[model samples]
Target: MSRQMEKTPAFLTVVLYVLGFSLLMEWIKPLSQLTETGNFNVFIVFIGMAFFLYAVKAPRWIGIILKGVFILFSIHSLYFGESFFQLTWVIKLCEHVWQNTGLLFSDKLDSLSNEFRSLLFFVLLWLITYLLRYWMLVKRNMLLFFIMTVIYVCILDTFTRYDGSKAIVHSMAIGLILLGILFFQKIKEEGPFLSFPAHWVKWLIPFSIFVSAVLVFGYEMPKSKAILPDPGPFINSILASDRLNGPRGLEGLDMGLRENDTRLGGPFIGDNQVVFEAKVDSDQYWKVETKDTYTGKGWTSEDSKGNSFYTTGEMIWKLEEQGKDTSYGGQKSAFLIYQHPMPYLAYPYGIQSISSGLPNNFVLNDQTEKITPYESDTTHPTIVQYGINYVVPEYQKKELESTTAEGSKNEEDPKYLELPKSLPARVKKLAAQITKGDKNWYDKAVDIESYLQSGQFTYDKKNVAIPGKNQDYVDQFLFITKRGYCDNFSTSMVVLLRAAGVPARWVKGYAPGNYTNSTSDGTRTYQITNNDAHSWPEVWFPKDGWIPFEPTKGFFGQTIVHENVQGSLAEKEQKPLAPIQPKKPLKPQKDLLDNGSNAKIKAPSQSNMQKISSFVKNHKTSMIISVIFFAIVCLFLFLYRKKWMPFILIWLYRKKSGTETFAKAYLLLLKQLDQYGIKRKENQTLREYAVYVDSYFETGTMMMLTKQYEKYLYKGAEDLGDWKEYSELWENLIRKTAG
Candidate 1:
């Protein structure tokens, strides 16, 4: 029957369901991008454990309420958690000591706290389950059991605020001591350990095994070890040009210019300017763009698809005669110093010969650039290209003014023209207004740039979703509400320049200003965050090349209060946009963070020093437990006492021998009555004890029973009856006590 109970489908069903649920979440990760929290995942495990434990013992209400409380906590935590500290209690229990340790838990503390909070909350609930099961459900002596639970306070205090091992040991010692005391109270003249299988006692073994099995399966206990450190930023994966496919598959577009247009920066935020350090043989402009006009967001030289992620590497070669053997591997190549990153895919600048680590499938682009398939996230080794360097040539502001003379007409650039269905009429109207009556496309371009920098607008950072059905977002930015950030400002700039007969294009790149600190490796690194995202307009500078225009208002946000400067165009040009007023609140603030016992951070700090000091001041519970434990063990030896005593003669010499003997006689009387089924549990004099002894015996025979107890226990007769005599006396006493 026990074996059948052990193999019962009820317990196994719970385990299978929990394992199945966890596996389902694990399997769905790749497709759904769903990430599970430690608390959420562990709650499932805890539920199964609680259910199994409850089922084995058949304590329905305790288990159900425990599960219900966990459910309440889980619901409160799941959608409401904003800070990292939120969790259920079971996690708190697992990490109580770990968190107090402080050194290893610093970085991931918030996540740890959250999971721990869940674990501890549930663990407490489970503890309650045990308490309710044992107390109310099992119908034990709840008051005595509660008195026993006082020892667990010592155990709990040590685990959370003191040494974990010490807590377990102290609790163990107290429990063993209590067991010895209880066993003493239970022993009989018939010999104590001979009880037959009652229904209640038979249930204990399987229930104990069930709890041990729950602990052993480990079916994901909220352990402390799963806490992990943050890995670096996410990187995309795409292969190289030497790997048979040109990055973005640009092999078909062999205009030679198509090779240099693939992305080469490290990590990108959508489309932004990613600048790489460039070195070359002589000073030259590293031209990412060799065209006069752009028709779309991307470069329009050739059309080929490319993976957004690819590995990166660089090579240097001497720009000597084309037929010469490169110095790399007996080929006459430039002695380059590459220090960038590996499998060098593409460099922003031109190179000469192969110097360092270069993956295969790379071909020289006009002996100037490295041609490889585009990869978004390749660990492109940092390498030095010693062939050529690029620097913009100095220009006079007045020299380019002649391009926009009065009555001039523009020859439409084919690549610059686009009439996408995506563009709206409001876009054209805004473009027409910005470029009104300018002599040529150049003046119109300059005029629009001036308008964008003006204070006639506001910048709205809160993303305006679906700017009405008929209008594209860019069109709405220019016409509907001239208020927006870079996406709005740049898109307007592009349309106006194109509409006014100027060859224009859009390019995503970095702006000049950034707060950066140098790394230990002497590399300049920027702590670029999500807030640093930006976009702007890039215009062709005719003979000099493309020049960048930051059309977005520079001082869109600032603390100093100021007003927009209005006057003649040139005067306003000299004036910057108004600063934001300090009084005008920019963003909403929330005061949701909690502190103290109400804190969502789960286990608040209960350091050992504090506990030790508090205990030192008065460890009442620990001291009481210590006293109880020691007293019981002492009783074990002190029953005889001389064996455990060091100076027994001294103790015996000072103490009143008769007085001690008399007190012991009373204790023996209480024990005899307890064994004979009549004793004052709390308080009774010898006379009251003799009267109570009459209850379990016949009134006529009660005198004999009392006489026997007094003779053996108080008069020092040493004649307590054996079982045969005691049985006869007990039968007569039962008759008398019936009255």
Candidate 2:
């Protein structure tokens, strides 16, 4: 006797399966909030469709076609913003997929477009749905997937901001029911057939009620705080590679003011805590300190070890020449109130003197130019408030541009020009390309600064990536990710400038913060928050000393860039200070390095045409080969589908013995026969189609198969013992289709 007397679960059990799987899918919704992953609703809909199709026992091919269509529609709606089934976005999607696939292999994950990324997500969902069907329906075992879902939801709840309380509740209620149903089915399959259903039902219902009641009681009970220490931070620390030399400090924390710069390039969350409030004459970047050394990953000060102590009343000049410079415009003072205490005081670039209410001596690191307050007992003092006197210089544009390499050669420091020996050569090559036509160091510096600010890089504090092992931070930011906060832009500019043989240093400080209120003395108070923490590059111009440049996108340095003037002293009075803004912040079509000194904005049509031309030029051979190979594979598959499908069906049903199995196998045979060109007409009955099939094959076996399938289909017959003898007939029919 064959094991063909199969019993499928009732409709209620199938509904339980769908509910359990749908609740499991609820875990995915929170990922959208936690990561860059978006359009989570599409995934939920797909999951529902998958479960619905499986619950109704739809044909496999029908389910596949429906899911594939929905995925295509989703991609069209989400990414393309075009009419459904339009060829335009389809072409665009194909191009994006091709380009991003190449980028993916090259480890440029951040560069992938939303379209291709969503496509990959759809593919993942497809796999997940199939797995769910196999585990829940085929094997009648969803315990592993249920446990995995719980773990996933719990982790997201703990590590991220996702609240999984409702999800857990849903999981528990649905999981218990699902597991109960599968357990019932399992016992039914294994136990003595005559007594199984009535005996199991008596125990199963009460056992389920007991489990659910206990769960409810436990859930409603008052819970105390966890006695165990949270190992989240410890686990995160361990997982985070110890790339930096010093303590991580504020680095990698969801706060501003990172102390250690030994490693950089990872994502960070923004902190809006107010660092300080400054009443200033004008918009100014509050300078904290400067780092000279670039150790591939991040900035470090090679010269901060030695600090010079200064009395509170004395003048501490930030400029090299102090009061003697003709470019020194006028005196300005800023009164700073510190909300967040730090060892160092944030002062302006051309600081003259620091005066405070409390009599505290200050210590200055000459190498980094960082000033810290100290007292009579040789201990550091907390700086609550202080007054800073500084000068805003009116740099002569002609003087700045006239200073050649030959002029500033003697003043150049090797330390400022130092780059890591392991630094990628592409950085230097890129710097050279950006500054190709620029004659003077000032223009070259401006060019490199402008290149960064030219809308190529994005200004993002969150979702910033940390450099992986053997990866250079600047290189990763410039060439790969192209998205970061001030540190990335500043570090990159300094690196590029250094690569181009220009003396530059990375300066960390605060940007000109939001204006809060105005005082009676005409001083504007700016509230500087932790979020206002910023960094930029300061290049050493021999004639003008160190001048700060803003390379970070969306930031405009409020300081002046002196434009070159024509004629002599008589015609050239003092030119008004112009705020340095990025010129032509357009996304260039060519390689970033190819954007030379003449970085003018191109017409959109021209840009698009150029892009097309460039893409064809670069990928012509690969595109041709890929298309041909894809076509060949598709043709091969289509031509031999009828030949291979029967083998697949035979393998699928080889170990199975059931009325449902016979039904499924018959449906598959009908599909195969359709593929085999013996198409069933729409008006024909099953018996008529069977007769036609039998007549075509010159056999009477299909008539017998049809009568048995009809009994299960209409009469709901469970025990179909004739399936044993007819199984050979089914196998013989399948084998005949292969020819």
Best by lDDT: 2
Which lDDT values do the candidates have, in the order given?
0.40, 0.73
Model 1 root-mean-square deviation: 24.1
lDDT, model 1, position 739: 28
Per-candidate TM equals: 0.32, 0.49
Compared to the true structure, candidate 2 yields what TM-score? 0.49
Task: Report clash pairs, candidate 2.
Answer: 265-465, 265-466, 266-465, 266-466, 267-464
lDDT of 2 by residue, 1-739 (tens): 0121125555754676566667656767666545545456788888788778877778889999999899888887775666775788888878898999999999978578777888888888778877776665567788987788788888866655457887877777777777777776665665566245687778677977887896898689798998864544333332222212224424444345666777666544334456788878777898888888899988788663587888875777745452122255666777787653455799886677777645578988878888888875446555656777777766766666866676667374579988899999999899999989888888888899889988778888566776654678888898998998888998999989888878889888889889877877677889887668888998887766787889999899855655654564335465533322222221223422234465433333334434554465478689789999999999998888888878887877787875567777788888888878899974589899999999999999899899988887877756565445567889999788888
